[model samples]
Target: MRSVASRFAPYQELAEHLLQATISEPMDAAHDVGHLLRVWGNAERLMAEEGGDRSVLTAATLLHDCVHVPKDSPLRLSASSMAAEKAGRVLDSLNWTAGDVEKVRHAIEAHSFSAGIVPTTLEAKILQDADRLDAIGHIGIARCFHVSGQMNRPICDLFDPGADRRALDDRAFAMDHFQTKLLTLTGSFQTATGRRLARVRHDKVRDFLNGLLEEVLPDAMTVSH
Candidate 1:
C-alpha cells in the first residue's frame, strides 16, 4: 500500500523542519528526532495495516514526540502536558486549521501512558502505539540505557519500580520506567497491528531482562557486561 505519510501538507512540511532542528543538535544513541521519524515511519505502517483516518494519524504519529526533553527524563512522567502546550503553539504558527490542530493537540496530549489520557480517537491510539513501539527493541534497549545513564540510574533499577518512582531523582527514573511503563506497553496497545508488533518488540525486552538477571545472578554462570 502507498504510504499515507505524504498526505498531510503542513505536517509533512513542518516535520521536515523539525527533523532539521533535531538533527542540528549534536546527539548520540538515544531519543533523537531521527529516531522519532523512524517511529513515525513504523506508526504509518501500522496505521496502513490497521486502517484509520490517515491524515490525523499521520500528523499525530509524526508529532507525538516532537517535543520530548529526553530519555527516562522526568518528562516521561511529566512532559505530556508540556508537549501538548508546545505542540499547540507550533500548530498555530503553522496555520493549521482549528479542527485539524485540535485533533493534533488531542493526539499529542493523549499519547502518553503516564499522562493517563485515554485516547478518544483512532489517530491518538496509533500515535501511542508508534511511540511505544520505538521504545522496545535494540533501539529501545540502547535508548533505555542511555536514558538511565543520563538520569544516573543504577543498572539494577530495571527491576525496582517503587524506588525508581519515588526517586524524584532523575537518576533513578529509568528503572522506574522499565518496571512501571516500558514493559507494560504491549498489553495496552489499542490496535491489532500495534499489538502484534508490540508483542515482538516486547519479547526482545523480556529476553534482555531475563538474560541480564541470569548472567548477573551469582549462581547463574557469568555476566557478559
Candidate 2:
C-alpha cells in the first residue's frame, strides 16, 4: 500500500491549514487530527482501487468533522450537515471552484452514519466508506474507548459486556458499540475495496470482542470441570 502522505502530497498543505483553522479546539479525541488523517488514509487506499474524484474526496475527508457535536447531544445526528455548511465557506475562502465546492459539500453532508443520505456520487461513497472504516478494528477500538471516556461511559458492562440480555446502549457502555455500529459497517461500505478492507478490520474487532468475553466470562471456557 502506498503511504498515505504520498497520496495526499498534492493537498497536504491546504488540508493542514484548513484543519488547523476549522477543527474545533479541545476536540473530542475520537474525532481529532489523528482521526482525520486515518480517514484520509483510508480514503486514499480505497480511492486508489475504486477510482473517484480525488480532490473532492480528499477535501471531504479533511473537513468531515469540522463541526464537532458532543456524543450525548441531540444534535449529534446533525454534525455532518453542520460540517458541510461550514466546509462550503472554508472552500470558498480558499478559492476552490464553485462546482468543486458543491461536490465536496455533498460528500461531507452524506458521510455521516446518522445523516441517512445515500452517497449519490463515487466521491461521496468513498468519503463515507473511508470515514466509517475509522470506526472499526484496532483504531476503532482505541476510538471507542476514547469516546467512552469522553462521555463518562464505562469501558464495558461488568455483567453483560456484549449486551446479550439487555438493551444495547453504547452511550452507557463502550463495548456495546461493537454490536450497535462497528460490527455492521462491513456490509455498509459502498466500494468493493471498502468492503474487502472492512471485512479484514471487522475480524479484528471480533477477535477483540471474543478475547474480552473470554476474560470476563471465564466459565464460558470451562469444560465441565
Per-residue lDDT tens digits of candidate 2, residues 1-225?
Answer: 123334467876776666664555458778887787888889889888999987787788878888878878899889889999989998999999999999999999999998899998899999999998999889999988888887789877788676667898887888788778888788899999999999889999988877877787764321110
Clashing pairs in 2: none
Whole-structure CA lDDT of model 1? 0.66
TM-score of each: 0.75, 0.90
Residues 39-139, candidate 1: write the lDDT tens digits: 77777787678776666665565556556566446556666666666666766777778888788778888888678898887778888888878888767
RMSD of each: 5.7, 4.1
Model 1 TM-score relative to the real fold: 0.75
Q: lDDT of each model, Cα atoms only?
A: 0.66, 0.82
Task: List the candidate 2 regions with Cα displacement exceeding 4 Å.
Answer: 1-7, 220-225
lDDT value for candidate 2? 0.82
